[model samples]
Target: METDRQGLFRLPFKLPSSAKARSVGVYIAGALYAIGAWSFFDAAIYSRKANASSVHVTFVDWIPFICSTLGMIVVNSIEKNRLIQDAMGSGSFSGSSSMAWQARVILFLGFALLAGGISGSIVVLILKFLVKDFTSYPTLGMGVNNVVGNFCIALSCVVLWIAQNVEDEYSYSLTL
Candidate 1:
């Protein structure tokens, strides 16, 4: 990026090169993941030790968080290079369309699980907390925390995907 050094025309911030940016992006994603997990765990602890209300964090609340975490694992486990190589028909198994098909199937399932986790969180919030008229913050916060945690997990995954691809893009540019 070129800088315009003619006085006040300069931008406030500088953009990093993809190679330089990947590390920072990965760190940010990891931080978000940690914060998300911490937030959900806090809710559970509060429910057990501090909460005075009838509401509690049971196995039901854990289901959505588990689903989202599993989805993240499934999604990140797929080798992106394989998808690209299969698309370009340049792999050692280039003649085998089944590999690509299987990859796509797995990718779809992972995304479905991710979406389902978030949706399930909302359903629990409505059906369990909101519908019962538990409008107080102490009880309502458990549901809210679940939603936030699941959302952050999804966001962390998105950031990681972009961060990983940035390195690949930088390498590709160099090859060209």
Candidate 2:
């Protein structure tokens, strides 16, 4: 006799299970990251080429972008299953546990850096532009671009996380 088992409720929205879907998500993430990078570059280049004001793109403006990119790289490089296994008590103290501890520390650092990057952008926007009373669009645009680019990178990280979590679905045959 076969028994019916209780299952968790499914979401109304479904992610595609095909490998192509995964590839598409990765491509989209890359595109978003590129857009963010280009936006920052645009601001920098604009400042060099046509800036009429004293305010310019400085090293401070680049720091947030660097932090975010580094965080994304660190977060993506971790093998997620190992962490999960460690959490579930499948890890040995000498080997798996140590690795898991390292992974967790690194992961925490990555997320901290990512959050710092986004926060730093907002700080620059306020302190550099708004606080200086530079309300004019041309002078303010550099700060705006930095904020927007950091936001785009954050979104790219989200997309990549969701894409990585999606699992392949298949069916199994039952014999009576």
Candidate 3:
């Protein structure tokens, strides 16, 4: 008698498995929320500081905090939606088994980190543009720090995105 041979598993490289994407999304959302919260607190503290005028804090610090908080909420919603889609096996996972959902979750987290970093950079840029005449302010160093921080965030996001792609390949190989 002759036996037929079959491949162990089909590779999913075109897009991350839905679960992985969702997990990454949630992680990103959570991180964004944390950052936004921290920013809000920092703004509040700065507003109370004697050196920083209330008007400056309200126009510069509070405005950025509000923007970041709003943006984070949007990110959270996106992540939640992705999670739902993954849970239902709605997108690329349609008709697929749930066996790889965990891996999908991990990938989703990685993506979230990437998204958060990128979003942070954008927020920083907005703040930088909104604030003018740092030299006239007592916190010139702080202003410079913000610029550097934004650059770092953008770089981190790119790195995370690349890592996610590489990680996916490695995970796929392990399963193979």
Report clashes for each candidate as comma-separated counts.
0, 0, 8
Clashes in candidate 1: how many? Answer: 0
**Which candidate gets the maximum TM-score versus the true structure?**
2
- Candidate 1 error regions (>4 Å): 1-17, 90-96, 168-176
TM-score for each prediction? 0.80, 0.81, 0.34
**Highest lDDT, which number?**
2
lDDT of 2 by residue, 1-176 (tens): 84432212255666787778888999999999999988888999998999999999999999999999888888777766545545555334344577777877887888888898899998999999999999889889999999888888988987886677556455243644
Task: Report the Cα lDDT for candidate 3.
Answer: 0.42
Task: Note the residue pairs that clash in candidate 2.
Answer: none
Q: Is candidate 1 or candidate 2 better by TM-score?
A: 2
- Please say which candidate is ahead in TM-score: 1 or 3: 1
Of 1 and 2, the candidate ahead on lDDT is 2
Measured with C-alpha atoms, the lDDT of residue 145 in candidate 2 is 94
Residue 72 in model 3: shift from native, Å? 5.0
What's the C-alpha lDDT at position 138 in model 2? 84
